[model samples]
Target: MNQRVLSGSDLAERARRAIPGGVNSGQRSIPGLTDLVITEADGARFRDADGREYVDYHAAFGPPLLGHNDPDVSAAVAEAGRTVDLCGVGVTTAEVELAEALVELVPSVEKVLLTSTGSEATFHALRVARAATGRRLVVKFQGCYHGWHDAVSLNVISAPERVGARDPISAGILPEVLEATLVLRFNDAEGVRAAFAEYGRDIAAVIVEPVPHNVGCLLPEREFLRTLRDECTRAGSVLIFDEVISGFRHDLGGWQAISGITPDLTTMGKAIANGYPVGALGGRADLMELFSSRPGGSVFFAGTYNGHPAVVAAALATLRKIRTEPVHEHVFRLGDRIRTGLSEVFAGLGLPAVVTGYGSVFVAYFMTGPARTYDDLLRNDASMFVGYRRRLLGHGVFELPLNLKRSHVSYAHTETDVDRLLEAAAAAARAQLADGDVLADVADASTMGGVADRC
Candidate 1:
């Protein structure tokens, strides 16, 4: 093998001596491709340990909306580091300022609670819902990921046959925990209605990703979102929109602003701090007041780095830049270009595929028809998609290895970047088609058991 590839392999071997899977995250380890050990990143690209560069579409799992090493965010973090790195005893002014910015930007957020990670935010959001409603059950849609917490981790990427079953993707989660969570199909209003009818009185919260991106960016039908709102309202269940991936990528107020439907609580991370470690849970003043320590009952929510000065400073800078600049316009334009260009490439090649997503996020599925729900997404050929992704990696594009994971576009990407991506994609498609009748095989393949095989 090449010395550069050998270097990455050696690093992986060394990591495995200490880490569990030779990678901190299981999803980072691509099966066929060499493990990428990134040394540095700037703008829309990142360099591997071998000094080879690739246009980065992973964006550190959708956090670097402003792209890597943004000057403004870096400067703010540096200033905070020089002044106050950690003040665990009391709250800082920067934290208050960031909270104010969040409250102003998000429509449903009258109050904000800072957490260290998205998992913590979602975990606390469920807690708040339970505390407010005095109920035990939580309803979540299939393929909507709300962090790795046990409460919201069930049915993230389940088998097609296990659609309505509350199956935990990760081990060590108690079966009782899964029992408390009711999993339903995404964009299926009738399924939701049936689930609510069965468990409406016991449902404490119904959490959803307004734009379900985990299973390849399946957008919510208008009536579907409205149904969730109406059901949650009538059932007295807290409506929680897990906007960790969608927040600020499309608009300031998230999909809530675009859809004109408000949730009772919202969880945000990723783009909020532009790659910094931060998470926020915000919602109506009355509901958020459950976390207050001043008077009545309070849910136990606290973290050592809850409002770290440096992290808050980074968030404040990111939000301010997003507010003043044309970041959304730039990313949205490029996203549309890529989405449209890829669809055209597939059509020209006579490949069975479709692209679906919104704003700066997109996913290419190896199926012809529309992908509206989790079951529909399962019909795509995972093996062919994985092979295509591997070929794209070789062609100098970096995307997540997961079959239907979302690919992102950052503010740093330009029209030239989109052109380059489409060129590489077209080449990848042609190359994949050259290897026998792959398109025919994809079109004829069964979707049911393939999903189970993936797990």
Candidate 2:
């Protein structure tokens, strides 16, 4: 552990005594306790309790596109708090403002339903789909994570034996629930078609991450997205694009605008509120009509914190900045610079890497070429990635802690930030390449290996 990061060691120690994993979120808890204890964050930098600062490429796990604590969003939240922050039984102006802004910002969305987190938004979306279509089955692709709800959590990560098959990754999710989920390989149009042909009539919805970013930032085939839209419409089932990570990231309208396809339902979170706990499900009017139907017909979606006014104000402010201002374009331009810099660094090191992204979001994958599916990402050498992460952290560059996910750049990052990140990356890559070679030699020497089990 770095001595500079030790100021929060006591805080973590106390947290472990109460929380299950010494942290509220799994991703927040670094695997080896190497992360700084973030005391405060503003713009593209976060400070530890000991006052150590680093360039934050994770961007609070792909939110804060306007950077942390943007004055407009914070002021909006603060002003709204002076009136009312939550209205469990009544609607507030903040909610209406947010809904209006979202509808205006996202092209395919006509109506909006708000929630506190991505998981709740997805759960409500699934329930709304089932109620609207009069079906029980939900189809999802492998490695597309739509939060932790039981219905969409299947096939998130499979064991090697279950790699190419559909299997639930957790217990307590009944077999019947798993039975209702049809999982297929991502980017495989034929598999998608076959599943629809067999069970489309019973499927309530086809839910997916337009960009499958859970395992890695794997882009969907253009034709596959179009086919999904066509099939869901033809089958009379709702199509859900879970754009929690992709919404307002690549473009203002999300991957839908980029892919030129429209879904019946779209779930967005993460970046919408710029790190505030807010999420939304929005789309076609007829599909959303299920939520307000008759007593027996209406999908029973209720939450104490759904459309919390403070968060709504933040989201409204954030979306307005993206739409009315040049923040999104700035983020895109900076994202290009970062990606180009990463490509040059990786290529110069003779490392197989590809930096792929559209606007603020991108991934530096250590592979020979682009990864189009979760299956392809599964084939990547994660050990090499872990080594790279460790080396980068040592050099004062804070990237996403997971090899399964990559870092993000925000509008707050400057050209100087990009240069510093590239320098850190080049140094990390070189050191990791040497470590990788040494590990390969050690593996060759050991006689007792069938496979290395890494979780």
Query: lDDT by residue for model 1 over 22-45, one digit each (tens)?
Result: 766546555554356778899999
How would you encode candidate 2's per-residue C-alpha lDDT over 1-455 as one tens digit per residue? 66743467777777778888776664566556533467888998888876667888877678788888899999988998898856587688778888887788677799888988888888988998888778999988877778777897667655456766656655588778877888888889988888889888898999998988766577788889988988988899988998888998777788888888989888998888888997889999776766752344467767788888888888888888887888877888888888898899988988888678767777776777658876666555666665676667677778754556657888788888888888998998888787676434332222111110110
For model 2, the superposed segments whose C-alpha errors exceed 4 Å read 1-6, 292-297, 437-455
- Candidate no. 2 TM-score: 0.91
- Report residue 390 deviation for candidate 2 (angstroms): 1.7
TM-score of each: 0.93, 0.91
Question: How close to the true structure is residue 367 of candidate 1, measured as C-alpha lDDT?
Answer: 92
Global lDDT of each candidate: 0.83, 0.77
Name the weakest run of 10 consecutive residues (lDDT summed) in model 2. 446-455
Top candidate, metric TM-score: 1
* Backbone N/Cα/C clashes per model: 0, 0
